[model samples]
Target: MSKNGSHFKVLFRPKAETFRGGCGECQTSCQSACKTSCTVGNQSCER
Candidate 1:
């Protein structure tokens, strides 16, 4: 269980970094729409 948890954390670390970096820009460009899409798992801005 611990091993799986560690692997999952590692797998998502880059995504977290990308989100931190891109989220600001997304918010600047799209405002509330970006936040809504992100929370809803749309990931349209991730492209």
Candidate 2:
């Protein structure tokens, strides 16, 4: 994750870097990833 992306994780899903909900609840980068898969954990990033 980038410097700012990490911050978003802290503010949003601090426990996990993967998708916790939908685009609205994820970070900007995560929002994009959620459409496919999260690069961080390579998990299903969809809602």
Candidate 3:
């Protein structure tokens, strides 16, 4: 996370394939919100 905590980044990919919904709302709901929002928002993710 940045010093100010306004923005952060993390590297992760869900092990289950049932949560590939369009929006990343599932990630945050599962307590797995990606810091960069790349998994769901940008749809460019790598585990």
Candidate 4:
């Protein structure tokens, strides 16, 4: 989280598998699935 309340660290907590959000552990109704590693705080992230 940043100074303001509009920022958050996008933690791509991969499940038992090696993928990020393709496994069943991902949010059941994830609307923002399979996106880049960037977050509100991270404008850019490595591939």
Maximum-lDDT candidate: 2
What's each prediction's TM-score?
Answer: 0.21, 0.20, 0.16, 0.17
Per-residue lDDT of model 1, residues 6-44, tens digit only:
544343445666565554345343446656665545444
Q: Assess candidate 3 and give its lDDT.
A: 0.48
**Per-residue lDDT for 1-47 in model 3, tens only?**
66778575656767665365345433343224455444555453332
TM-score of 2: 0.20
lDDT of each model, Cα atoms only?
0.50, 0.51, 0.48, 0.42
lDDT (C-alpha) at residue 47 in model 3: 26
Each model's total of backbone clashes: 0, 0, 0, 0
Which residues of candidate 1, in runs, are more than 4 Å off? 2-9, 15-17, 23-42
Question: By lDDT, is 1 or 3 better?
Answer: 1
| Pairs in clash, predicted candidate 4 | none
RMSD of each: 6.7, 11.8, 14.0, 12.7
Comparison by lDDT, 3 against 4, better one: 3
Worst 10 residues of 4 by lDDT: 38-47
User: How displaced is residue 27 in candidate 1, in Å?
Assistant: 12
Better of 3 and 4 by TM-score: 4
